[model samples]
Target: MVTKVVVVVVVVVVVVVVEVVVVVVVLVVVVVAVVVVTAAAAGELVKVEVVVVVVVVVVVVVVVVVVVVVVVVVVVVVVVEI
Candidate 1:
């Protein structure tokens, strides 16, 4: 009876230890994956920011050119009337 009790205790301890180790390993893997995903997302955001900046700059330049042409045309009309 004592021998059987001892065997049962040993088995329970082994299962508990194995369960703890598996939980720890799973936690570590989840942390690593989260870090990788965050880094990748940050890299993609930087790429998007660069594209947005380029687009904004181009739009500003085009607007400036259009405004200047309009002003020149107005000035010509005013001068011709005078």
Candidate 2:
């Protein structure tokens, strides 16, 4: 009877240990995956922000050029009329 009890206890302990190891490994993998995915998302956001900034800058430059050209043309026309 004592031998049977000992065998049962050993089996229980072994099973518990295996379960703990499996849980730890799964947690570690989940944490790593989250970190990697977050980093990739952050990188993509930075790229998008950069593209937006470049586009805004280009638009502002074009607007300024158009305004300057209109003013110059008006002044030349007025001088020619005078």
Off by over 4 Å in 1: 43-82
Clashes of 1: 0
Residue range 1-82, candidate 2, lDDT tens digits? 5665566557556655665565566556655665676588875533545545655665566556556655665565557556
RMSD, each candidate, Å? 34.4, 35.4
Span of ten consecutive residues with least summed lDDT in model 2 = 43-52
At residue 78, give the lDDT of candidate 1. 54
Model 1: how far is 5 from its true place, Å?
0.5
Which stretches in model 2 have alpha-carbon errors above 4 Å? Answer: 43-82
Cα lDDT of model 1 by residue, 5-31, tens digit: 566557556655665565566556655
Per-candidate TM-score against the hidden true structure: 0.51, 0.51
- By summed lDDT, which 10 consecutive residues of candidate 1 come out lowest? 43-52
